[model samples]
Target: MERARFDNLPLEWIRAFEAAARTGSFTAAAQETGVTQSAISQRIDKLEKQLGTHLFLRQARSIALTVEGETWLPHVQTAFESLRQSSEGLFGAARSRLTISASSSIIDLWILPRLARLTEDIGAQLSLRTMVLAAGAAQEDDTIRIRYGAGDWPVAYKVPLYNEMIAPVAAPELLASASDWKELPRIALSGPRPGWNEWSARHGTPTTPLPALRFDTFVSALAAARAGHGVLLASLPLCAGDLAGGKLLRVCEESLSCHQSYWLLASNEAVSRRQWNRLETILKDPVPREGA
Candidate 1:
């Protein structure tokens, strides 16, 4: 029997395989491809037969990609992206309108500062949609979304916003007034970033002071900290530009390297392979803060 040529693998079969591998479920792949689960499974089976290797480890409730599947996934995604780039180059327009759904704090702190550069670099009309739910933008169906996590968003291209580095921050006046930065009134945030208790535990400080003020939103807490209300356990990456410009002062030398981070869930349509390199630079690399 002759080995099957790579190009002979049907695009639909490849799509089924890619979707199943990425989502880690035949049902999800079916939903994404607008087909039934049986069809997804059948296509994958055909592809596996063609390749003479199993792509997924079948389990009771979940599926794990075989090493071959894991290795081939990126290549498939890249090929699709290349095809998109060529099509876009020949037939697509000069600029596009893209809406980003995320929490208001991320819009205000991280993405907004680079708005001008981001739009210009990517050639898109950028629109910001502030997510109202406590879940943030994770549940949104917008063209782009940002989520906070350990960055395992396999279904979409994960554009890393930042690794969370948190430290206590305060306005200069508050720091000057208080002799011990640790004893200053603590401002608390309600979400994922670690608060005073975690900070204290990590630093081995026995007494964890109660927060003088608490807010459900990071932006509000940050505003309070900036207004000299209290010292905030700040996400350093989110406010790196501000720290660089002396708008906020890091109270201590120590910072906790929380394993989680904010990720921009980008698809090829959200940011094309052609534009992604430059777009990533605009997002990940530091830019000049506007309206300083």
Candidate 2:
């Protein structure tokens, strides 16, 4: 006997054939699969040609499975169902291993100090990665991403984390010694967003540009601030610890909202996990009071 020819049988046609057989109507199957009834019929007809067997007995009002279809239906349905279940299982497991990617400033100033408290074992190892916001959007594989922006995204789940509120901060000695705001040297905290001009506008200070010492990272900027190097326009949360510790002081009470916010994003695959739930729980916790 000649071995059965599988070459003529297409996976798409098999899928269509399976759906039509399972639903007992071409019209119903087409609706489920988002295709036209005639398309489903054509697929089934092609499948039948490939197999040299009639799979359905068509009637004006309804359809009934022929002997061959009755035989093939269970196997096809079982295979597809098993594939779907396995895929879900694998995806769920992958999602549990959380890798959070964000701007370096956020990781250094906000997330690093607080991670020890999320001690629960959720069968996932938490990891952090940094990417440049100015470069482009997060890749499709990134699990949890915190970005600074207005949060307009297409085809994604996005949540506003915090507004980029900023104010001038410096070591206690630097503020005590500077004659006025105009006398201080400007300092650059490494990140894409800028706050100096915005601060000047909000505080009614003159827009005379000051020469800034550039630091490659927020942590470096914080270090310089702590050492009384210059005036640093820093994110509130990023400098929260230093301010609380008395290492750094806010230069002025007034702060300018940068209009950009930190947003939490997840790919569809990463959103469904219990680990993501736990991460969100950690993120949503209120920042401790300045002195607390």
Candidate 3:
């Protein structure tokens, strides 16, 4: 038996056939794909004629895939699904010039202040978007995503950005007046990272609830700490400015080494773009030695 050439098969016809096969009814497939049942039937008919094999057997109100169609259904379904995902993803990326998705805290405390230097030095147009950590999230269209995680990204090449450190911090006045560590107010910030609990555990101090003020991002938590509300569990580099300016003070002599590091993850297709390259440079820059 002669086999039909794969290139000769119209994509539309294959899609219609797959839909009809999956749904077991042309009317249902038409409803799913938003095309007339007649159009669906016509395409399948054309495909059958092209392949010189009957793809479906008609019944009273529904149809069943012939042996040939049954054998072809899985491959066609997989191909169409891959095509759909690629088209949607690439098209979305092409619409945006440059978008960077990062943790809200990093954007607020670290990246936002340093944005001007990058813009001036790199001399490129760019935009930043922020998001909280959630599993399997698309940060933005064709955007470079700076993620804080252990260095294993299932997709995309992961570049090590930097390791993070956390310590208990508060306003200078609050620390100066504070007599006992137990009496001090502890501010919980952002997600459950290396915070007061970790600090308490390390020093074998009893975990006491200190009139907690909770925040979803480090920026707000740092602001609250600066306002003299309470001591905050802050990322050292992120809170470096406030710490230097005397807006925030380190309450704990000990710090936690967060094994989780920051990473730069970009879509495979978007890696060669100029905007992505500039962002990569800033991410990989050497850490400055305490106000150097």
lDDT of 3 by residue, 1-292 (tens): 3553555678789889988999999999899999999999999999888887899999997798889989989988788867766665455343234566788776776566667656655454567787666687654536667777887876544676666888888888888776875578888865747766677888776678654688887778878889988877778878788878888878768788888867888875544334445566665654422211
Q: Give me candidate 2's TM-score against the actual structure.
A: 0.63
Model 2: residues >4 Å from true position, as ranges?
1-36, 39-94, 119-122, 132-138, 190-192, 271-273, 288-292
Candidate 1 similarity to native, TM-score:
0.69
Please give the range of 10 consecutive residues that has the lowest summed lDDT in model 2: 283-292
Model 3: per-residue Cα lDDT at residue 63 = 91
Give residue 92's error in model 2 in angstroms: 5.9
Of the candidates shown, which would achieve the greatest TM-score relative to the real structure? 1
For candidate 3, the 10 contiguous residues with the lowest summed lDDT are 283-292
lDDT of each: 0.80, 0.73, 0.74
lDDT of 1 at 286: 57
Task: Estimate the TM-score of every prediction.
Answer: 0.69, 0.63, 0.60
lDDT of 2 by residue, 150-220 (tens): 88765245676666678888787877886685577778755566756666767878666564688777777
Name model 3 segments beyond 4 Å from true: 1-96, 132-136, 139-141, 273-277, 286-292
